[model samples]
Target: MLNGCYLTPPEPKVITITKPVPILPPLYLLNDIALSHPPINTNRELLKFAVKAHNQKVLCNLDKAALRAWRAKYE
Candidate 1:
């Protein structure tokens, strides 16, 4: 007897599990919300055509109060 009774070896089992990620809300929801707001729609259109320096792209907000004050002085 060699180290307790030894029979056939255990079989090898390979299990493969794959997980997927979902990108939610979909395109239709985005389109609907975009249509609901006028300012957002206008901003989106402006972004499509507005061109700025490569380093300053996507930065479009300005200080309305300061701009109004400056314009008032000139008026």
Candidate 2:
């Protein structure tokens, strides 16, 4: 039986629409991996760790500023 149909079904009409994906931010960043390793399970441990991290961050900033100042002289 001869059927009057195209050799293959026509490709679906693709309508490409760009949509901005909405990213939902985390409710709490306390669980972020960047915060620390060996995740803390106790409030006391977390507080101690947080204080250490804060001090390290301040030291890192000072080192970065010193490096930038030295680099600026060469540039």
Candidate 3:
């Protein structure tokens, strides 16, 4: 009778789920240097090689830094 209506259960609440966005690391481009041997007749050739090697080292360090930053933000 009318008492049955009062005994009915209430409707369930709707839950909303949101996904988290992914974090990405920066991209680094490496230089393509020729690995062939160069003539050592003058100091200029040695200096050129030294500069190229230094630049490559710097780029590698930058890559490591980017990875560290990404890991810090993620974890």
Of the candidates shown, which would achieve the greatest lDDT relative to the real structure? 3
Q: What are the models' TM-scores?
A: 0.25, 0.49, 0.44
Pairs of residues clashing in candidate 2: none
Candidates 1 and 3 compared by lDDT, better number: 3
Question: CA lDDT of each candidate?
Answer: 0.43, 0.63, 0.67
List, residue by residue over 1-75, the lDDT tens digit for candidate 2.
Answer: 557663887899989999865443333421222345468999998898888998877776676666555555555
- Candidate 3: where are CA atoms >4 Å away? 1-16, 21-42
- Model 2 spans with C-alpha error above 4 angstroms: 1-35
Error of 3 at 15 (Å): 4.2
Weakest 10 consecutive residues, lDDT, candidate 2?
Answer: 24-33
On TM-score, the candidate that comes out on top is 2
- List runs of model 1 lying over 4 Å from the truth: 1-7, 32-75
lDDT, residue 15, model 2 = 94
Candidate 3: tens digits of C-alpha lDDT, residues 1-75: 688668667899999999997765434332223345566777988898878877876777776776777766766
